[model samples]
Target: MAKLYSKKKLAEAPKMLPKQETIDFILNYSKALKVVKTSNGTYENIAN
Candidate 1:
């Protein structure tokens, strides 16, 4: 019989949040973008 799982300890990872500038930039830029999916398997940008 073989071992089912590893007995090694996992390391602790730190979580970081996005900067204020990055969040604001994305919010502004994303507002002008529009995406639409057609009958085919391709994505189309319908923003005008």
Candidate 2:
């Protein structure tokens, strides 16, 4: 649940997008990636 929140936060962070078409792609793609919980209670994306 925390991981999901963090991903949502990251997706919503202030960042410049070059094109409006890419916004959905970025948010959906980021949410789709698998993340692992670290020892420090943070999350890290698992590389494909």
TM-score of 2: 0.34
Stretches of model 2 off by over 4 angstroms after superposition: 1-17, 37-48
- Top model by TM-score, which number? 1
TM-score of the candidate numbered 1? 0.47
Best by lDDT: 1
lDDT of 1 by residue, 1-48 (tens): 255465555776788899999999888777867777678766646343
lDDT of 2 by residue, 1-48 (tens): 787666544366588657867888777778778877778786767444
In model 2, the Cα lDDT at residue 48 comes to 45
Total clashes, candidate 1? 0
User: CA lDDT of each candidate?
Assistant: 0.72, 0.70
